[model samples]
Target chain A: MEIYNYMGYELIEKIRSKEITIQEVIQQTYERIEETEELLHSFVYLSKERALKRAKNLDAQLKNGKTTGKVLGLPIGVKDLICIKDSPTTCGSKILEEYRPPYNATVIDYLIEREGAISVGRTNMDEFAMGSSTENSSYGPTYNPWDLERVPGGSSGGSSSCVASGQTPISLGSDTGGSIRCPAAYCGIVGIKPTYGRVSRYGLVSYANSLDQIGPLGRCVYDVALILEIIAGYDPLDSTTVDIGVDEYTKELNRSIEKKTLGIPKEFFGEGLQKDVKEKVKKSINKLEGLGANVVDLSFPHLEYTIPTYYLIAMSEASSNLERYDGLRYGKMSDDLKGDVYEVFSRTRGERFGSEVRRRIILGTYTLSAGYYDMFYIKALKVRTLIKKDFQNAFEQCDAIVCPTMPTTAFKIGELVDDPLQMYLMDVLTCPVNLAGLPGLSIPCDYDNKGLPIGFQIIGNYFDEKTILNIGYQLEQELNIYRKIPPLTIRGN
Target chain B: MSKKEELSKETIEHISKLALLDLTEEEKEKLSKQLGDILNYFKKLDDLDTTNVKPTTHPIDGLKNVFREDIPGESLSNEEATKNAQHKKDGYFKAPRILKE
Candidate 1:
């Protein structure tokens, strides 16, 4: 049996049936990692010895007639931003490169307790989850498995790359703008940004607190659904976590989209979108309509401002959130302190932060500074409310909003390296959901002529992830676009 | 798209100081140019009317007490916390003394 080609659900079945031991699965995963990691550069830290130890414990439990939960013995790749006890959670920043977390994140606890999931390792990410492509990671950029020269998307890029290359069946990523979805789109994997507060964000190492959400990225919708079911719930620890009962997402996998109404927001596909992406999105929509969904034209006039509004709010929050890293409490400190208290702090920060992080921090500080607060930060917040209101009004007319996940397919690595603003613009289609606190899913829709994957994004009303998944599942069954794997073995370039 | 404001080298130094950043002359010039472009972009926001709109801090409404309870939560040991520090001594973060009375 070709183990790497199997989905997480299939692997779970094998474990339950005793056809293969969980340890064997883990060994095979490590074998694949060792074989391909040189070209892929997906992981920042691999906990092979620790992961095998966890797998053995799980195996003993299952042998004794005890099953931890649905995702028993599944190998899960965690993004470095999510704190895992005893493992390094660098968030791809050099300042905290060697810092090992002392506590597991709430989601990590959930995965460990209820699912018995083995956290194989921590994957790389953009520095402090700040950039659009993983190229910004201090370690190195994780290359696209599809085309080695192309980039796997950013922030969550390492996680997405691991899943795409079959190094792990599933992974966890945090979305603060399009960090999760963009990488998923670029890598041709399934990524879901669960409704804000649906998944606890207690130990996520805050990038932008309001925008940051821990979500699942997997090869199949069911796998993502299973992970979400395990990790999402009300946590008093996280007051933003709603008191809503967690839904059985796996059960909703087969939910039909018959008679379902889908809204295609026209503004998403109009300008700045590539022709190839437009064609693929149209084909996917047609395929969805063919599968009994009623596609309608939807308008959110305020959509044009999603990018600007998102940057302002995200940078402002990031500026405040990052202040805690001021040499005294957490992260690194420089030794060149020859000045007063304030000057010492300045010197420490000046030496620690990277260029992009410093840029955002300064911009955010200026916006939040005394005289400019009302002009930049406050106005952006007002616009954010209007953006949410736009989605609320649109959802009232349609069940979900469908659009292209990104303007174009994955651009070549180093293409936008010099232009920070241009790279930021790639997240234009995705930031609105975070602004509105809505749920969105990015699924593989089609591939461009070059065989690079194109993704279609479906956003739902707050806490309506099941409906979005249902539509995605329906389309998945009809189109089956994920069957085409990129020809990485042949080119080897 | 309005009148482009050229930031003086001295003003760049001042902003960098306020931002707690120590930049070289070359870095200062490059950043000053990039920051000027970004600040100009933000100027576009001036056209919007935010007459009485309250700034939205947390995305969710009624965001109160998002902190986890302090019930013997796991914390980093002094050793672990100071392990990544460039300089440390005796399980504590070491820094140059600041106050000279």
Candidate 2:
């Protein structure tokens, strides 16, 4: 019954072979959630009735010799941002606390219909996907399953923590900047931020339109690859999705990384990067070199400019995108609607939205406001072009780029929650990838001396997720970190 | 780094208004300092010379004006669309008064 620790693919095969019924997996999933949710607090809403119904249906269909679909009989924890039909999809904000989405996100449609994935629940996240740690959530921070005192890097912290703690075998998360990768690194799991136009973003609550992407997170490269292949591809519903074909990611995962060139960005190893993270990442590079991949030193000259460039661009878009949230439709409303529309809008947002959400919106409005737009927003945009060019040059000399997914391991839960500037700075390593709209994967490389996980980031050229995935898949065979489970799960069970 | 980035209290007031958020005195006071520091941090972008470099609005190239056949598609029903509304009347998302009395 402790099948929670099994890989997603293994669970699917076990169900397919009749070694275990789908009911057993579903029962175990809820049981795991029930056991640890008090401390982990990873899930915001548990979809018990609906998930059980789907599990029973899938079990019946299996008995009838009609298979569901590459399926996971196990649960997949969906981030609160992605809409699920009639499901409470609050992006960890109280503003939309009362609202339930009427339709499923395209990824949800694909996940349920194409892959037979069950939703254990909607995972927790930073409110409006604004913070680096999951502490900004209205429901409360999702404690790091590895170290309860520490954070699970967010805004996908809940998704990452759930997988790490064995509450779910896999989870889906959206990354605008470092939401997915940071948590993956912190919680010792695998996560991908696919190219911007690679996956459908429809029904995902937009934080920043241009920067946001929905991706998969799991305990291993294979779990992530399997989920990515299922959710990827063009859908007419999401025009931002590319018409290009998605690779056979799970099939293409086992290819050798021999002769592949990896670029190590010199800027990534510079100041403020923790000593432990640097050493662990450097050791990972040597492992890759020993595995037949070539490692080359490179520099992204405009790298430091990325923080400002990313924030300026992201905040401006967030301000514009969030304009639709007025009291009248889809969320908690003000009691007094007698005031003018502006009063109503302002009061609702002020009362409902959390502090971090307010700060982003306020700063976002300032950057886009008169007299400042050219100096801040426009300048940031042009610098975005230069950052893109930097990656373009690096990719020419190397097949992929590797760096520490985060500058440091997961800090204590309350460590960086205050000091907004400090929290924003934590995203320096990951946001630059979003600026270029490239595919980036974070795999557990090595552990710091503190017994915390360190994530190794493999960033790929646009639309080239397969190479990075293959590299991660191959690297794990040598390091063998995926099979390791966090002690927290064992203790909790 | 030539000059410190600072947000004037009045400017923060104006921004809060533009963003349409009613603010507490504490929020304005806190944001005035926090945002100024962030804007100061953002000043790092000025060091780069982006002369003639086109801004990347969206990362992918040749990804605009996606043309599909003009046709009616399955759209959300009125009830479904109004389902999440805080205030709805007659299958419509009812809103607060736009004009002051």
Candidate 3:
């Protein structure tokens, strides 16, 4: 296999044994990136010089017998929304195109300084992590590696696309209402949205503070587990993070999930779910049953309200979180001061933000406004409680909930861009997990007749990521479907 | 109260102002219609009986204000803080004049 074909954990072992130099891995990665990037459009910024320098330093340390961090010399792609000091964290928006952060996110610090991972580039995303398809990205959409004309899902589309195309073995993405899982499902890879507050949100550019979480995307379940082990922990900087022990996620990967009951949410299999997706998910459930796991039919009474509840709460939080980008402190500024302070704020934001962002902001402000607060915002919060209770009730009957990660596989570019509601519905199955603040993992199970990958989601109770990871690992071993590289990746060979 | 299902153009304009966004005429028209559709969808939440349920502002339960000792520690230097500012003057962010002198 080519060097780029090896997963991050495999590369780390090889590099540590001195069989391959970090420089060789870095060079091969960039070569693959150069070959496939134009067609995939997966990245916004490539830090070639810095990455090579870091790799050279790590290689010297390895030769000198100096101890390096756990994921030594691994190349990783980060979603543009995460702050990396001295890099242009554009968040796929034109407003912050020139803005460079002076501080790294806690997760970046853990990955680079502690884990010895080299960040290869900043991947593209939906602007402010808002849209379900990366078509909302101002830098242009990231095409699915599976099919060039299809979208790779968003707002973390670039992260998932890079992993799927073998451009990067592991990457980081933030999920706010299924940003990570949607892309992971569409691109046919492994991605997890860790339970809310399991990972710190200190440096993440907030879309919806209440729902957003930073997680890992990789080609396999173990790679996802490895990255999660490194990045998940308590951070003093983020008060919302639960002060709990971070498990060695890989330790439990080989454990059997036999006799564990899995809940199949009946609502997820109904209506908008495509037929092929349902079949693949059902087959995966049977595979689990074949592995000695039991399956039970479960119903979430409030499942229909997930989209509305999620949108209301997410938009309300986003309007408040995004109010900080008014051109005064950081983002793009207008040439003229215009009429007044209010005009400067409005004009700069109006001209800089994309239409979807503008629409959400307007909706959010309206929902939170005095006349509508009780009716929309407060009512949504109440429904959010009910959603949480629904998950709690379902978890009482099973170890985890298994469902199709998305309603369908990769949709064509420009397919749902003009229709916002249809695009929002793309997250129908995944957002319920986010709404309830549970850990959700997406791993490729089967493909449609079109040869596009379909993902099955494993959702666990609050902070119980280990259960879902173990379950996903068992199914992944049984299926063994992730080894096929996209035809675009073969072009790099 | 009667069902005020459709969002008016005036309401969208007011919302744009509140969100600190300046919308062109075409955008206003499109947004008004779109927001109305979305709001109509959100109206589904009204059917649920949430009379006694407490609103869940955050996901995790038993979350308290995490307090720490008020001890001085190293902080970001002014240069680092203002490095990304679009307009900086004399080590401070420069903004448009808000009040007349």
- Per-candidate local distance difference test: 0.84, 0.89, 0.91
Q: Model 1, A81-154: lDDT tens per residue?
A: 99897788888886786788777899998997666888999998888999888988888899999998888988
lDDT winner: 3
Model 2, position A188: C-alpha lDDT score: 95
Please give the range of 10 consecutive residues that has the lowest summed lDDT in model 1 chain A: A484-493
Report the Cα lDDT for residue A276, model 2: 90
Write model 2 residue lDDT over A298-395, tens digit each, in one string.
Answer: 99998788888999998999988888777577888878775777888899989888898888888899999888898989899899989999999999
TM-score of each: 0.94, 0.97, 0.98
**Every prediction: chain A TM-score:** 0.97, 0.98, 0.98
Q: Give the better candidate number (1 or 2) by DockQ.
A: 2
Off by over 4 Å in 2: A489-493
Please write out the lDDT profile of model 3 over residues A252-370, one tens digit for every residue.
Answer: 98888889999988988999888999998999999999999999999888989989999999999999988988878887887768687999989989989999999899999999999
Predicted structure 1: lDDT: 0.84
Fnat by candidate, in order: 0.48, 0.90, 0.84
* Candidate with more favorable, higher lDDT: 1 or 2: 2
**Number of colliding residue pairs in each model:** 0, 0, 0
